[model samples]
Target chain A: MSDKGMNLTLKIWRQKDAQSQGKMETYQIADISEHMSFLEMLDVLNEQLISEGQEPVAFDHDCREGICGMCSLYINGEAHGPDRGVTTCQLHMRMFNDGDTIYIEPFRAKAFPVVKDLVVDRSAFDRIQHSGGFVSVNTSGNTQDANALPIPKDDADKAFDAATCIGCGACVATCKNASAMLYVSAKVSQFALLPQGKVEAKDRVMNMVKQMDLEGFGNCTNTGACEVECPKGISLDNIARMNREYLKAAIDK
Target chain B: MSVVSEDTFNSTSHFMGTNAVVQFVLQPILAFGVIFHLSMGIYLDTQNNKARSVKYAMNKPGTNSSWMSRNMKITGIMILLFLGLHFYDFWIPELNTKYIVGDMSGLNEHGGMRYFEELQHKFADPIWVILYVLSFVFLALHLLHGFQSAFQSVGFRHTKYTPIIQKLGNIYAIVVPLGFMFIAIFHYVSQL
Candidate 1:
């Protein structure tokens, strides 16, 4: 163990299948570097498991740059680890101390069934996006100059911010209802703000909401947890926009 | 022989008319009333949060309500579930047996009665009755916090209006659930 390193304990969730029982197994790692990312610490621990002839823990990770959003961990009852506006992969081990006990578990939701250990089926999100997350454009010659549309700066900035959503399931994982409104709203707002998407706006909101309900995902309670846990700091304003769009679309129908 | 048939026909027609009034006219109006008040309350609260955020200049971190209070999505989900079960137990079967399955000119599935028989039958099961009452309890909890919070969020925290709104919210929170509970218990005991 290095002089600057710390010893830590981990209680991780282990489950083989959806129908199988899950239990928390504890492991101890000594001399962990504070400068290492949280995922790197997990890698060191996995190496020990492999050398010890034990099966390694199953978890998801891709694009550790925080764009892919495949890495998700609930650390000490906080979603996406203890930090705000940072994903599990981005969280550093320096946030903790020596001899600290960390409870690591996969995001729990009925809609997001656990596929392996830490991996959950977030295809429900993909389904919601498919419902109405795109602008309806036929491949044809550009009709107007980009600046000719003249979108207000405020609206453009809001749209760009909403577009920053990485389609991560962190919002759903942290939400008490497992609601996807924040993510869905971001997708809806991204298009609804631009003139190119105005033509299909009505159909978009209606179909998306209908699909959301049908997916067995819970409705938005407006608790703002999704916004809080979002790594990109997606605002709840997009949800408000979604509500307004849903109302108008519903009334028109 | 002719008198008996005429009497049956009159009774059947009367029941059918009342069922139509309750199912189509009354229930929908009540549902819409709930939706309107609740949506307005939510919108007002949202606006209030926005104004408060601007006033504070920076985000207010970890200064909100408890998990349950913060998460109204869970409550909305429960309400939606109850609505589905309620519609299934009462509206669907009523519409099906009375208008669809059985002839409108004759006695419906549960005899020549509408509210009394159907309500009683649905509430007869102890589990069903318990579930309905529990759902109302959840609704009351949600409304109590939501109503007051909504008013306060919309800048209604005045000396006079605040108390009045709080009182009204309390009354509303209690009365609505109690009324529904009364109906559920009434039907359940009637079966016994």
Candidate 2:
């Protein structure tokens, strides 16, 4: 725990760009501070690469505080680097030991194509949300009174829980089938649970699910893996709720 | 239990093997269901694999999902292999008698029902017994994730009722395979 930090071996996937092939390249670090966040440790590696006249690794990160949902890496094997309830940015170097061989790769799925070494395109999530991730409220100066609508405590709380999903692709990366059901379900549940989202609930579930399928994500086999690896610990109940919503919407339509 | 008494076994087997409804209606429906399930599973497994064209260098799937849930395709293929052997052992013979050879009499040369003796003769082989028992284990694994999963696919989920269904699914998964295994071992042991 003194000034002599941990010496580590890093196996990182290096890709020139989306079209180029990728491979795991090994690197060595002499002293990595355990207090450094996983992203910060990568920064050290990139800085080392720059000084050595080698190409730096490409990765995604924003809001190092873990709020932006932009940081993504499949560290070792688990998404967000083996820690629970935290994104890769929040993962610390302390989780590993000295001389540990750490494998770092991008969050992978056909829907989330690898843009570079550790950056995958997650715009597929955006497309699904675009279809029906919102409520149609009047904002043309005829806005309704916000406080007038009262949602029950239980329903509001559940909605808030569902709303906490940051649209990260970790669920897809962790899933064996690479299913996006959890992410889609969280969005569907957030809206389907409240009065503001009730009017278009059926159409919302229908369109979002349709878009999700169009994105080529695999079907859910109810493995419950996504829920376990989710950084926000989003409940599997949201998936069940989405199933119910989708079924009802399909039936009524 | 049937192996202990020739008369009891023949009566029960003859009843089931010769009954018009069991032969004509139930068997056809059961056959269709098994074929449909196997085909659908193969189709989905292939499609899912195609979704992930590239493989990961290191993956620890056991950390997040149960082994049974993650390896459905493997267990499913195991069950498929078992079914091929099972149909050869039992269904082929039944088809030979009922349709090809046209012996629906359920009789032996001595003018007695042969169902009990035929059943015993099949289990007399140690290899068949061992293979059948091993297949039942795979069946149990397949059902462990499958039973509740089917309900989930149909969207029959509730806070109070879902947990109950999952528990019931586990019981069903265990008991059905256990029942098959017990009968298999019992028949093989009783013959000696």
Q: Give the Å shift of residue B92 in candidate 1.
A: 31
Local accuracy of candidate 2 as per-residue lDDT tens digits, A82-149: 78899999999998999999999898889999999999999999999999999999889988796789
Off by over 4 Å in 1: A1-3, B1-192
Superposed model 2: Cα runs more than 4 Å off: A1-3, B1-6
Deviation (Å) of B150 in candidate 1: 5.5
Minimal lDDT window, size 10, model 2 chain B = B1-10
lDDT string, candidate 2, B79-187, tens digits: 9899888789788988899789999899989988888888778888889889989999999999999999988887788889999999999999999999888877899
Show pairs that collide, candidate 2: none
- lDDT by residue (tens digit), candidate 1, B1-192: 112354554566456455768668986898899789668646744533332110111122243225445645567668878989978876576567656876454454556644444445677888988898988888887887788766533323454576787689889998999888877787678668
Interface RMSD of each: 13.5, 1.0
lDDT, candidates in the order shown: 0.74, 0.90
Best by lDDT: 2
